[model samples]
Target: MTIPQAQREAAELLARLSGAAPVETHISAVYVGRDTAWKMKKAVALGFLDFTSLAERERFCRRELELNQPHAPGLYRDVVPLTRGPDGRLREGGDGPAVEWVLRMAPVPAGDFLDEIAAREGLPPRLLDAVADAVAAMHAAAPRAETDPPAAMAAILDGNVPSALRAGLDPGRVRAWAAAARAELARVAPALAARGAAGFVRRCHGDLHLGNFCLWEGRPTPFDALEFDEALARIDVGYDLAFLLMDLDLRLGRAAANRVLNRYVARGGDAGLLVGLPLWLSLRAMIRAHVEGTRGRDWSVLLTAAEAHLAPAATRLVAVGGLQGTGKSTLARALAPALGRCPGALVLRSDEIRKRRFGVAPEARLPAAAYAEGVSAAVHAEMFAMAATALAAGQAVVLDAVFLDPGHRAQAEAVARAAGVRFDGIWLEAPLEILRARLAARHGDASDANEAVLLRAAAVDPGAMAWHRVAADDGAAAAARSAIGMKGHSMC
Candidate 1:
């Protein structure tokens, strides 16, 4: 049968089964029923993929089930064969000769899709955090892949420029972006190689944008991962994450993007990933620009964003220090989103680092022994090292800790100085009674401090405080931003 004939038959069958028109994409059609949905790949041979043969379709149908089931088990049900009997009537599953294959999945509410949610009601901070957690968990469990990071990235750049030009984007802008991207790739090649050697390269969701996620079991679950191309999906985790970050920045706002970036890194993502973020973000935006342009949509904004990603931005270090419950973390989070680059600075919190040192979650409480002088010293050292690494990568750093020791505070300044970036320190101060009350009410926090711990910290005479002392109140973040010479409202 001709390809068009097969396509028509599949659509008719799905429509009959679903009792409604099917949703169509360039490559596939999905029929949504009351509780279930069936997806069938079209019998068309695109340059990147060809699903014209029944055998090929069956193989990819099973491949889709394998790739997505582990990530969203509740949504990806199974791959079933559409077979024909002796009478030549098509049925979903049987022992007859198979004509086509379909992937069955649990139907999700349209409003529950992340993109739909973003359009109807902006993504809340809590939901955004959950999205970060979900992506981080998937990355942590992904098996590492062997590939040349620099070469893989170079290939993407090579493919994108011509595609953008062909899709009717301005040739001048596309060419300019190509030159800047190549230069950036050359600059970060060594770092990318090192990240690959350190096993940061892995099999990741190639299309990790907001539209590829849905609310499943009351949590944001990623689905419809790019399953047809292994080379495209097997990539650096940082590159995989860039798609989501770029999407959030373009759709929601930079503040939302900043929250996800910080949360992902805090959940054990390598801070070194920031080294190539500019290039990765630009590449993702360029892809969207061309895809939209090809469809005759408004893609000028995306093209402009692609150029902006390569524009240089100044990096700096900002440290927020205070006793427990002085709201050092709160102020740090509030100030981080506007600090440096598009997604803002990386907030390195001592409490979170200490928890990581103990091989526990951020909110997991540690024993008293875990906070001994030696352990505390190690935590501070790691925090400073991470700050230096991020600074060297041209990403701003935010140190969140109680600088009870003057030496630690000095080291924070020294890291910035070594990186040749400006440094600013803000000391938060709050009433003793308020500190005790706040510490008492805290739960599920990274800091294990309590009333007793707060008292001990308060007793220490933090020796002639020299940093900008700001009152810990509702305006603390604004005051800190102003003190740091930043002229903008807080984004967090």
Candidate 2:
């Protein structure tokens, strides 16, 4: 923890900027270097990060440039040879023998960093859209690697846990949380690895956070990626994107978090990437909590209660069954915003779940190849899992899907039973005329159902249901409220 002499000298030099520079408080030694900052590896020999020699630093610097140039094109200066002058001063270019090498960078504006701006404004919708777009672009541009992402992720958790404990957090509580997270990761590893094999894991900004992003000419720009380890940067895109999503949810509110996630998923056109979001967001929130606690920053005030904000409030989940284009998703959407009034209520739509499984947005028109028998099965499994997980964790999950098949209905009922929670099905019915009209006029919908799909779905049996019936032509809010009223509850 001792400040090295080199860092001390760098601090002194930074105070002597040529022109008037922005004044700041709590300036890091890393920031106080020459006008063009010199970034050396923090050394890798320590089993964590060892950059012992100039050669290693040069190698990692190239990796940094290779990984970040596309995203931070203007800021990452070229890797330059660092040499000492005749007067023993480290200079970029001077008549002296080379002593070391480092990656130089164009300094970012102090006030433009997203953390400073968002902390002040709490992440406006425009900024959220920009962040979502930036992340989607990064996911598209990042390269995939054939490596074990789980092992790499475990190492990060291991390092962070000890640091948190050392910083005076309750060790028992930390271990308990870590154990739960590890258990969930084990359950999902096969799915994650499968996605990775299918080209979802990629080179990412290993240390993505608000501080790592800044506004440059009205665009969100990312910089200062983890330069030392390719393993750190190579990860499932969901795990990578989860950092930002979870951070937003913790720092802002659920509504904004959901909006940003919707925007990101819409732009990326990948619904499969979202399956791991709940778990990843949970892990990310825990990581941020540990980091804040360890780094002497007060983040507890910003984070929601781990238990209260854990999942959408489901206290009791009720599955709603109906044909496609019969207003299933509309009812779910109306219920979701209202669920917000009750601590936490999140409606996990089957349409959205289906689109995500095929790696496309729900609104995107996909070919039949995208929904092969196997894909169909996978999508249903995901829907069941999402609802079960949320409901089990004490959140109300309104499953929005066409229950044309009895088996799908059975599986959902089984989840409700196993969770020991009350479950009900709200069946919606609309005449063929009503269905066609609704489908024809529907635009900007997240569901992929078309008039033909609805016509085909309308023929399936509604099956016996412990259900309440509602008409689709009636106002969705009124129907939804009526359904709740039938259960002796008030939607308002």
Candidate 3:
């Protein structure tokens, strides 16, 4: 709907009086009031429609406040009636009459914007923790939705493809990428379908990019959700989390994204969503690039920048290797976000992929059929293929594997060379006593190797890979910091 002339005039007046008000490019007009802000959607009919009638707008105004307030208390304000006198003059709470309704929102400080904070100074650990906690709480509080992920994705993907093609992009390449994305999604459809059935689906903040998040009183808050459709906002927790992962891949660290994932999983104790994250993240990035490009002229730069960042980031593959119980998984989890700090970095864990392929849980033992010579070869072959595919596309990749055999090491090196990305072999080894204690205390662990595997592998010469060893101790984090070239905290 086009913004009514009166609304536009009112917005201009509001902007003049308030310090925070500004005319946003995507929306028709936005302005700040004394304690809150307002956005008046243009009357233009795009792929998504807004309230057309005055009464409809009033209803939407109330719903926006109702929906956002529960999660973002002290952030959203009541939608107050805007009165226009009989003489056709509009004013806030005028005695004359009710002309329309404005969706009011509590004003937040400008410095609270995460993107602004990240651009100026890399995100602080405290903020990262806050954001993770906020989203976890949001997911926990949300009610489950009935729709499945694939069908929801299809509609969104269809809606986004046209805009991407229309942005004077290569249609053939876009089409090919879309096909690849769809195939990846299909591969994980069963897991996604189960999430939908198990009531993991909920009303989420559909667009969870950095810009929509802010810190108020030292806590991360999500605002301005997709109010138009319940299906868009209502989704699997993994889908909601994928937005942040994609955003992190686009800007901060892949290791950080991994850390975020691990923290969320540790809190919720659900890794079921792991398989769906990468595919969903890719789609989310693609859709965002398209939306920014098509929405307005000012957004062209955002589109170009996102295309450049995401095109390569979509491919980074990480190769991880360490003996069982030496903290290979822990270090890999830690390293993921660091590698992802650079755009186009993706970490593919062998454990997760292996479990997915063999129809076993991460902790389940593999059957003989699943680990026969041919089957083992096939698993590695597929993993290498995935790693290479992501890397060839200019993404930084981390592959987590035991690298027990010299042959596996060679294959991984060949992939790095073929893809022209630097390869780092990380060997995490602990003291014999530490390994013994770690293995002995394990209860229902995912790692197949126990004391026997550790004892055997410890004796077998880890000969050639000796140069890459990182000692596991209290200083383990320091070793990791050195491996990644991150400067240590300075004493002010």
lDDT of 3: 0.66
Query: Candidate 1, 434: how far from true, in Å?
Result: 1.7
Sorted by TM-score, highest first, which candidate order results? 1, 3, 2
Give the TM-scores of the predictions, in the order they appear: 0.97, 0.64, 0.65
Candidate 3 ranges with C-alpha deviation above 4 Å: 1-4, 16-21, 85-88, 94-96, 295-334, 338-492
Candidate 1 global lDDT = 0.89
Q: Sorted by lDDT, highest first, which candidate order results?
A: 1, 3, 2
lDDT tens per residue, model 3, 157-198: 677678788865557766776777667667767767888998
Q: Model 2 segments beyond 4 Å from truth? A: 1-3, 7-47, 86-88, 100-102, 149-160, 297-492
- Expressed as tens digits, the lDDT of each residue in 1-492 for candidate 2 is 432354444333333432333233221124324456545443336564656665776677787777777788777777776566777766664556545555667766677889888788777766776787788888888777787756666676667678767666666766876676676567666766777788988877877777888887689987767766677778888778777766665557555666565566556545566445555666666667766776788745423333223343336666777877688866664555344222234566666666666666556677767657687778778777766665544445677777767888888889889888777677888888888888888876666678888777777666676577888765755776666653313332
Q: What lDDT would each prediction earn against the true structure?
A: 0.89, 0.65, 0.66
For lDDT, candidate 2 versus 3, the one ahead is: 3
Residue-level lDDT of model 1, residues 1-492, one tens digit each, is 122575677678878888878777888889998978999888888899999888998999998888889989879999888887677888788897777889999989889999999999999988998899899999998999999999999999999988998899999999989999999999999999999999999999899999999999999999998889999998999999999999999999888998899878888848889998999999999999999999999899999988988888889999999999999888888888787777888999999999888878788889999999999999898999889889988888899999988998899889999999999999999899999888888887889998888888888988887899999988897788888898885422
Clashing pairs in 1: none
Question: Higher-TM-score candidate among 1 and 3?
Answer: 1
Per-model clash counts, in order, read 0, 15, 33
Top candidate by lDDT = 1
